[model samples]
Target: MEEIFAICDDITILRDGQWVDTRPLEGLTMDSIISMMVGRELTQRFPEKSNVPKETILEVQHLTALNQPSIQDVSFELKAGEILGVAGLVGSKRTDIVETIFGVRERSEGKILLNGKEMRNRDAHEAINNGFALVTEERRSTGIYGNLDITFNSLVANVEEYKTKSGLLSNKKMKSDTQWVIDSMSVKTPGHETAIGSLSGGNQQKVIIGRWLLTQPEILMLDEPTRGIDVGAKFEIYQLILELAKKNKGIIIISSEMPELLGITDRILVMSNGRAAGVVETKNTTQTEILELASRYL
Candidate 1:
């Protein structure tokens, strides 16, 4: 909204695949624009922080990836029931941190400890078995099966659970879980057989997140979770994250939006040149300090 109001002189509003209004930006406020776009009055941009941090559940000690010019000697601890935000500029390798932890990227040298025990996540399969789930940055390329239906996309990550004694996938279980995703995440879809590619970006993201939740992971890492979504959708995602944190799930979010980090996370981990620059309490740190640390190792 800020960027649109700043750069564009005129604005066009769309609602439910139909055009709402097109008018000049003069005398227009964010609330007015958002109301028009979502067809509802959104009172808050972000939900209030309510999750309380608990004992440490994950520790990354001197983590380094195999790829050259990537994350090196990065370290941080995530406590159960906490929301940890990763913030950095473009090309800072913010996504690499979660990828490395999730075993999407190999770690050349590092120590990952879960519940005070060493964990070797050498591959994505191993990471999933170790109770770790990641929602990748590129939804089209890595997150969802665009051509597949909602039923397939929602149950793909945890398909093993839907198997019957005959070693075949159960259609009844699949339909039940898919319906749960739609209802719990508020995903708008005509039916479970609807192709995921036809849904909007926000609905696709919600389906992906719901899919991960079905796995019951101990650690959840989201990369740009709310990107390209409307304001109402972003607010719902934020509330969902907070709700998960209250359940004692450790969540790590990587976002380019600074206000989002400040609004949702308990602590902000600033990355610089593929390294862990610094970690600050979100309540005590400002955007200026985060930006300063982001450029520290440049």
Candidate 2:
């Protein structure tokens, strides 16, 4: 591949069925090529951080999932208005820890405390009722209703809030709230009645986050929030995360991207083979230090 590119005089870059500029390989370096592909410099990926509060909002003690015992004895405390990032390589069982805390996975041994009160391992509904919301990693399969319209997808989590005294759904409140979500989140859609599947990946993610926000969660756990989105959309999502933290929400983020963790998080909890390797303040830690910690248990 290197020899072919070296011998070639001209190279054509085709993206999304559209022709990009044909440039000669003589002056086209990898960095310049990438810049052309993304339509911007690589330096402006992550947004600025929001200030974090001091009070602890959620605490997990010695958490071990029944189905995933690899995540053993993990414990952490998340403060209100803080962006706490969870970082690890693939198969580190990072997903298991959050799922257990959110009651998606059963906990064999653990204690979850929400503002100093012990939460029982009932289920996801119980977790949600107690001010916990989890935006799962698999957004396409679990998060959004693809065939449904934006209004249905947005109000599905907290549909009861729009109920009238007659026990029927109120179209007025539903429309109003849906419009508010669309506007507040800057979701790109032709109309509220447009099918969610027709929207872009970034817009779908925005809608999903909007749905969870409507539930009024105190602790918001996002697993790989910006996994498949484009660069521009990723920045928007990062900004939204910071905005949420500004509102005093304890945000727990699980991302495989170390730069993303370092860029946006207040503190990063580095996991090694599902165990807590180390917790370091993002401002004081480097990517090399995080990788070192993440490889400790292994």
Question: Could you say which candidate leads in TM-score?
Answer: 1
- Candidate 1 matches the true fold with a TM-score of 0.96
Itemize residue pairs with steric clashes in candidate 2.
Answer: none
Would you list the C-alpha lDDT of every candidate in the order shown? 0.93, 0.86
lDDT of 2 at 137: 96
Q: Candidate 2 lDDT, tens digit per residue, 1-298?
A: 3674768987776432347788888877766765665567766777766576779988899998887546999999999999999998887889988788888888889899989999985788888899998888998998899999999999998988999999999999999889988988889899999999888778899998998899999999999998877665688799899999999999999998888888999999988998998899989999999888888988
Looking at model 1, residue 46 earns an lDDT score of 89
Stretches of candidate 2 off by over 4 Å are 1-43
**What would the TM-score be for candidate 2 when compared with the true structure?**
0.88
